[model samples]
Structure formats: C-alpha cells, structure tokens
Target: MRITADRTRCVGSGLCAERLPDVFDQDDDALVLLCADEVPAGLRQDVEEAVQRCPTEALSLDADAPEH
Candidate 1:
C-alpha cells in the first residue's frame, strides 16, 4: 500500500507518529511527515491503524495503486 498525507488537514496531534514512528514523524513545526512513500510489508497493519486513528483524516492509503 502507498501512504499519503494531507499536510493541510493535519492537526499535529502526533497520533500517526505515535502509532507508527517508522512511517510517520513530526516536523519542527509539528506537522505530520511521511517517512516512507511506500508502506513496508511488515508495517501495513500499523499504517492502517495510523490512518484510521488520524483525527483529522489527513492520512490515506492507496491500496490499489501499482507498486513502484
């Protein structure tokens, strides 16, 4: 799956980073940043949880997209 973040909608709640630090992080301004554009096979579940738990709905996954 491919993960994408909408920075404009991020509230910097840190939930995404807290749920999956390997794939999400907070910038100096406390905005959400994607650590990896492509989700790692082992971290798909964590990514999904992060997306689901994102209060602002800023995190999204494109499961049907072709892998690069």
Candidate 2:
C-alpha cells in the first residue's frame, strides 16, 4: 500500500494527521504528508478513517490488496 497527498487539493484541514498521526504528517502549510507509502503492518483501519475524513479528498491510499 502507498499513501500520498494531493497538495493541489489539500485544504489544510489536518484531519488526516489528527486522526492518524502515525501515518500522516503535516507540512508548514498544514497539508498532510505521507509518512510512508505501504500501509503499515496493522494500521489499515486508521488509514481508511483518515482517507474518509480528508475534507479535500487530498489524502489517497493505493493498496496492493483491496481494502478489507
């Protein structure tokens, strides 16, 4: 899995970082940064939640396996 942020679309909501700090980080602009691409060993749920909470739809995850 790979997580990335579309800076062009990010609204600086920080929702992803607040909800999943382990996976998401924010730049000075408040846009979330991807801590890693692959979904960590056991943080799938958190990642999903973050994606869902992204106000600007800027946070996106690409998983080798469909989200389960």
Q: Which candidate is the best by TM-score?
A: 1
Inter-residue clash pairs, candidate 2: 1-38, 2-37
15-55: candidate 2 lDDT, tens digit per residue:
88887777888999887688777778899888888888887
Report each candidate's C-alpha RMSD, comma-separated, in the order given. Answer: 1.0, 3.6
- The regions of model 2 sitting more than 4 angstroms off are 64-68
Give the winner by lDDT: 1
Q: TM-score for candidate 2, please give it.
A: 0.83
Tens digits of per-residue lDDT for model 1 on 1-68?
A: 78999999999999988888889999998899998999988988888888999999999999899866
Q: How accurate is candidate 2 locally (lDDT)?
A: 0.81
Q: Native-vs-model 1 lDDT?
A: 0.90
